[model samples]
Target: MTGASAGIGAAYAECLAARGFDLVLAARRTDRLEALAETLRNKFGVAVRAATADLADADQLEAFAAEIGADDTVTLLVNNAGTSTLAPVADTSVAAAQAMTDLNIRALVRLTMAVLPGMKDRDRGAIVNIGSVLGFRSLPVSTIYSATKAYVMLFTRGLIDELAGTNVSVQLVAPAATATDLWDISGVPLSALDPAIVMTVEAMVDAALAGLDAGETITMPSVEEADRLIADFDASTLALLGASQKSAPASRYLNVTA
Candidate 1:
């Protein structure tokens, strides 16, 4: 796990440790990572290594990627490290926005690339990407964050398509307002949101794991009818894609050629 220091990432670490998976926890905070590692080791009797690295830094990211590439024991990768700027595009700083993009998209892509070849060789592995419910809709304030998550969702789905028939599985976990520090980072207090919509981090991770076990490509924890919603969206998307392959432009665009 990339952001194994806190919040949902930390929760995932605890859950995975409880399940007897030895862990390699990575984060910028060496102190926190080491503390979590110690706790997991003592509690679960599983090997835990703390890797301190800022994934937004290319040098650090590649260093970690190289380590993962060389280590054949890695069977699962949870791409959970991400940042968000929950403000209007006009007000958000360019540097902060770029950092968010670097961590959320670029680093994720690079890490996935680093692990895939080896996973294919092993014929058994899984990649779980942390996405958000906002990925499916247009939401105010969370515009860029949602777009990045949308990329995550589409990216994982595309990987699922290519990895089919292999033992490798790619899963996108889209949690809906989970109880985490993300709201604090986004400048929204947890109390500001409706209590009914917020789910505990444990619940979210449990549902995501269940979805992974059930062979689902996309997992939306809060949605009661997720399967129906996914089926409907996939049908519509397939129709649109099929229609776009026509030989000629549609009548709607005939007179409006640019």
Candidate 2:
């Protein structure tokens, strides 16, 4: 698990530990990571290792991925480490945007690649990628963050197809407003959002695990009618695919002048 120091990641560690899985928790905050590891070890009688690394840094990320790749016992990888910025694109600093992209996209891909070969070789493993509903529709404040999540959504969806025949399972968990420190870090406190939409971290993780048990490729914790939305989205994508196979441009574009 990445970002295992707090919020959703910490919750996942607790749940997974209770399920009798020994854990390797990774995050930047050494203090919190170690504390959580100790707690889980005592409470669940499961071994937990806390690894501290700033994932936005390329050297640290590569080293961490290499270490994880070498661990043959790792059967599940939860790519939960991510960062976000809530400023408009023009107002957001380039450094901040790049940092977000590095942690959210780059780190996730590297870590997933690290665990995949071992899982494929063992022929029994699972990968759970945490995304956001913003992936489907971007807001002004979440433009870049949403784009990264969009990549995650499609990437995991494609992985599902690639790992179809294998015993390896991949799930994409897309959550809406969650009651986590992420809101405060992004400069939007939880109090700013509607109370109705904010879910507790425990509830979100539980629902996601339930979805995984049910063999759902994409899990939306907050959406009540999730199947309908997924079906409609899939149908629309298929229709778009069918429409794009023509040899020539559409008749509407042909009549237009540059």
Best by lDDT: 2
Flag regions of model 1 displaced more than 4 Å. Answer: 256-258
- Clashes by residue pair, model 1: none
**Model 2 lDDT per residue over 1-258, tens place:** 999998999999999999999999999999999999999999999999999999999999999999999999998999998888888999889988998899989999999999999999999999999999998889989999999999899999999999999999999999999889999888788899999889999999999999999999899999989999999999999999999999999998897988
Give per-residue lDDT, candidate 2, residue 158: 91
Spell out the clash pairs found in candidate 2.
Answer: none
List lDDT for all candidates, in order. Answer: 0.91, 0.94
lDDT of 2: 0.94
* Minimal lDDT window, size 10, model 2: 182-191
- Displacement of residue 118 (Cα, Å) in model 1 is 0.5
Taking all chains together, each candidate's TM-score versus the true structure is 0.96, 0.97
Candidate 2, 207: how far from true, in Å?
Answer: 0.6
